[model samples]
Target: MSFTVLLEFQLKDGVENAPEILREVLAQTGAFAGNEGLEVLIDDDDASKLIVVEKWASVDARNAYVAWRATPEGRTVSAS
Candidate 1:
């Protein structure tokens, strides 16, 4: 079965381009193995609040992705 992951982020004031940055970061996420799809949701009353809905092929796939994200290579991609 498929798995879903929700990630919430609260941006500080003055970060008007946060969505654009998220798009750039999500490019890598979308290309990762076993990633099915994803969607970005913004709070109706709070633009600074964002939620990322990620779909994976399976729970194991999502776990593997999370593990990879903890590695140096994954950290580099996120830190960029």
Candidate 2:
């Protein structure tokens, strides 16, 4: 079956830079091989809460992507 991943980021009090951070993060993540698409959603009641919805082609694809993210190379690139 197709896989969906939901990543939620809860910001600390008064952190006002989520847009910039999301732009960078989404760009990198959306470029992954298995990513069918990505969407960023904001909480209706709280501006500080954000959710990233990722659609993957398949469960294998999603698992592979998650495994790659644990590698040193993935860590380095993701930190940029």
Candidate 3:
């Protein structure tokens, strides 16, 4: 079965560089193996809130990606 990951992020006030950070993180996410697609959605009522919808080929693939995100390199990418 396909796997979907929903991530939510709340930006700090007046964070002007959020767009660049989002682009970079999403770019890295898209290049990950087994990724079907990743969509970034902005809340209609809240500008500071963002939702990331990620689709993977399978639950295993999603789990693997989650595991990788705990590693040093993955943490670096995530922090970027």
Candidate 4:
């Protein structure tokens, strides 16, 4: 069965470069394997709040992506 994920993020205080940082991070994630469909949105009521929606073919695919990120030997996603 297909799986969907909705991730919520709040921009750090005084993050003027929030958009650029988000875009780069998303680009990197989408470029990775097992990422099928991805979309990001901002709350109309709160611009600093962001949501990322992803649709994957299966739960395994989604788990694979998470595992890839969790490993010390794997890609090191920026954490700022």
Candidate 5:
């Protein structure tokens, strides 16, 4: 079965063009193993609020991806 993950983000003040930044950052997420698709939703009333919808092939696949994101390599990517 497919698995879905929803991540919400609240951008700090003076963070310009959040959607563009999120698109760039989430490129890696879309390319990650078992990733089926990804979508970003911005709140109508609050532009600072964003939600990331991630679809994965399975629960195990999602767990594996999360585990990998905790590693040094993943941390490096996240830091970029």
Candidate 6:
């Protein structure tokens, strides 16, 4: 089955490097094989906050991505 992944992030105070981060994230997502697509939306109340949404073609694909994100770096990324 297909799956959708939604990631919400709040940038640290004065973290004005959203563009660079977005580029990096986009690169990572693109490098992955199972990404159906991705969408990034800015929060209306906080410009520094964003939501990254992804669509996958199957649960296997989504699960693989989740597994990838659950690594040490993923834990760090998910923590804050």
Best by TM-score: 3
TM-score of candidate 2 on Cα atoms, chains taken together: 0.74
Q: Could you give candidate 4's per-residue lDDT for residues 7-80 as a string of tens digits?
A: 99888887666778777767767876667888988899988898899888788888888887688755654545
Off by over 4 Å in 2: 14-18, 76-80
- Which candidate wins on lDDT? 3
Those runs of model 5 whose alpha carbons end farther than 4 Å from true positions after fitting are 16-21, 76-80
What would the per-residue lDDT of candidate 1 be over residues 26-80, giving only the tens digit for each residue? 8878998899999989999997788999999998888888888788877632222
Candidate 4 regions off by >4 Å?
72-80
Q: What is the C-alpha RMSD of each candidate to the true structure, in Å?
A: 2.5, 3.0, 2.2, 2.3, 2.6, 3.4
| Candidate 1 Cα lDDT to native | 0.82
Deviation (Å) of 69 in candidate 2: 1.6
What digit string (tens of lDDT, one per residue) describes model 6 on residues 2-58? 678888987777556656766776777756778888888998888778898888888
CA-lDDT, candidates in order: 0.82, 0.77, 0.82, 0.78, 0.81, 0.74
Stretches of candidate 1 off by over 4 Å are 15-17, 76-80
What range of 10 consecutive residues in model 1 has the weakest lDDT sum? 71-80
Candidate 6: segments with Cα more than 4 A from true spot: 70-80
The sequence of per-residue lDDT tens digits that candidate 2 reaches over residues 1-80 is: 67788999876765466566667667867898878999978999997788989999998888887787788855522222
Output the lDDT of residue 22, model 4.
75
The estimated TM-scores of all candidates read 0.80, 0.74, 0.81, 0.77, 0.80, 0.70
11-30 in candidate 3: lDDT tens per residue? Answer: 87776777777787788788
* Number of clashes recorded per candidate: 0, 0, 0, 0, 0, 0
Model 5 TM-score (2 dp): 0.80
- In candidate 3, residue 72 scores what lDDT? 83
Better of 5 and 6 by lDDT: 5
lDDT of 5 by residue, 1-80 (tens): 99789999888777566556676668878988899999889899998898999999998888887887788866522222
